[model samples]
Target: MDIRNRLKTTRRNLLGLAAGAAALAIVPFAAQAEDGVLKGKNLAYIAFGLQYEYQVTLVNRVKELAAEKGMSISVYDGKGDPSTQTTQLLDVVSKQPDIILLNPVDAKLLQGGVRKANESGIPLFMLENLPPEGEWVAYNTFDDVAGGAAGADAIAKLIGGKGLVLEVRGAIGSGQSEKRYKGFHDQVAAKYPDIKVETLKAEWTADNAHTLVLDAFTRDPNVAGIWAHNDEMIRGVVSALRQINRLKLAGEEGHVPTVGFDGTPLGLERIREGTQDADVGQNPFSMAESIVGEMENHFAGKPVAKETLIQPVMIWKENVDSPDNWGNRVN
Candidate 1:
């Protein structure tokens, strides 16, 4: 058999063996059991980085929910390194936790680890990221395309639909990054003929974004606006703009009306301070809640979605402090 068919057959066989060994716990809905509280189960949460405020926020929500539901969890930090993440995934698989939650640093590096988890019958969940080319119980997150499109629209509106806009994107191969960029770029090109969008890769970190921002400012000093794929990179952009003495508020005459995604607390705070124009908000709490809920339901023989797409929210300076925003809940 060819590779695709071989993978399918191997997965099927592995799942069959897993189902026989762990029963409905692996097959999901194969047993006639009622749903109950998630207790005594071990969950592993692996994030790309915790240093970033949003990721720390995401991990905190997961920890809180898992604790409330009576499940014990271990959090592993990838530290923005794919090799480190690969090692962490291997360690998680070795532990064979009841459930695994992964926000991968690199999809390719995690395929083997995902396969190992599948073969061992441990349910795996992906949060705030697309599933790798392997097995996953489900992927729970917002529509990055919507977020990007909304941000682009906001940017177009802010800049009068015509100007040179720089795009600060996440890691080179990030699924979310690619989707966000495409959606934003497509909308800008389609609806705003006069607007020009340029891009740079930041690897979802502030440091890379900071360096790129400096270079971009030197070459494109009159850049009408800038859009970062996430709030983390926005912070870097803001810092760089401030260093060059070019930062301005949305209404200010010299302002560039920078736009950001993620609506993180820092981003929202910047918006209020006029360092940023607007942001698209996503719920990390909802992402974590879905992961826990789905895992519990699947184990209880209850129905659950294979994929859940949460809607995105657009946040302007006026609503930065609204209770509905994830930033408001941040400590």
Candidate 2:
């Protein structure tokens, strides 16, 4: 079978196992933190899937931090199923974890789960994308809108504020995607009015992005730059450009400058090779570390910020290895 199919199958298996384990276990309130470290302090990490490399990195970071703090982390991979996530949340709620770190499939649909956790007197640390509404102990998010704006601004600067811009948006209903799109458009409207924007949704996938780019280029040949919400989509966008032998054709004169978010290895490689223009890197490792700290503080009856914002780095060849750069720290 193909890679996608294999990935899908693996995700299904993981999800099934996670759901079953959660159901079988009847966890009781084991123990709370004495000093800084919480012994047997239960924490639930509910994710959509472990298929994505970012997700794997982030989850592993959480596990690492938990191990350091003497906390127990029970994970739930929903296998891209919202219903399964809801069920898992219910199971996690029954276990009565001290904290619930959630990355929801749909922000709006997760309101009930958030509410349930809250009603159970559990602190919630929402990572990355947020729910549509409700209060959590901490809402950790990157300035995706700013990242998008920055990416767009970078493109505009490269083209001297005048060019045909092609935008590769992420999946619909993804709060980060929406924010990124808004940021990009807002920047374009303010800083580069001479530049026209044409957007196509890539559904947050490289393959979809490739297909979308191909279609966009078919209609508009003079697409000067491509700004994607995620690096995965950016890779797809580049793949599409390369496939049509239009990689050199889409630039200002003859080279299309591409910018993306999530400074993943693939995107970094492109940046190193002088193909991808820039990427916004959010340090998931640091975020995971912070979450553990907050959880420890909460267990110790100390105050923690209800909302935490992590500054993202604009990564390029020049700043790739700078002290402030976010490398493979997620590992």
Candidate 3:
């Protein structure tokens, strides 16, 4: 088989093994699971910002799961402020945690901070986003570019390759936003010339997305589709559509076909309810586990890959009920 097929088969096999192992170990670990929490190890999670509600879920999931690995997690939120994030990095450097898991707010702004951490000999894990600068010990995130491309391609095909699209992007300068924008732009520009694309920046929060989407809809009532970089933005786009009475414009056959990333609980529900067309499902809970696993390896003096790009799956109404669908979501 070709490399792409080989990689697909390998990923499928790994998931199957992980599931089988979990099923078998559950009963035996019921008691020990509580006692196996990570202890006596300190790790720092440096974030680009923590304005999204999803961050709470990610934080809780990681803390609950990482505890079993005997590690304590501390969070330094940048509050969507890159300068503050930089300061937070300096603070983390002084404290010198065994490892740092970062979700950078601004990819470029965090370059210096990440470099400093690496220079201090502390292992750094960039989670769900990348720095604008040098490489790190390990980088864990969904394939946002692919997610964006898939989302846009779906919309283009749905609209018969002709329509105006408004894309609500995430925080400016963040890797997620950049990659997703490029993916959407690249795919549509290359394959669907009839599709017109307009981009707008959002704070990566639902409220901001709602506001921007609403205004865009009012400005351009003929917009045939919408795409958001993340779930929150998708939700915002949907909400704005509902408010402006445009949600009904693209129903079933002719609906505007909205798409998003992260496949959060809200995004999944949107698909089930038939309001959203599709979403790229990413396993953040698994990502959290992987982060701790890498941290453990770091503590044990093992080499970690410089970059780890997790695959993203597309979810649609047809396959929303499938077992595979649940594997990509957190809860």
lDDT of each: 0.77, 0.72, 0.70
Cα lDDT tens digits, model 3, 152-242, are 8888866778989888888777777788888889999899999998887886877888898888877888888888888767767767877
Q: What TM-score does each of the candidates earn?
A: 0.87, 0.84, 0.81
Off by over 4 Å in 1: 1-37
Candidate 2, 213-295: lDDT as tens digits? 99998998888778888786876877797788866522335788888888765566567665688887777677777777777
Clashes of each: 0, 2, 12
What C-alpha root-mean-square deviation, in Å, does candidate 2 show against the real structure?
A: 5.6
Model 2 whole-model lDDT (C-alpha atoms): 0.72
Give the CA lDDT, 0 to 100, for residue 323 in model 1.
93
Deviating ranges (above 4 Å) for candidate 2: 1-35, 79-81, 249-253
lDDT, model 2, position 194 = 93
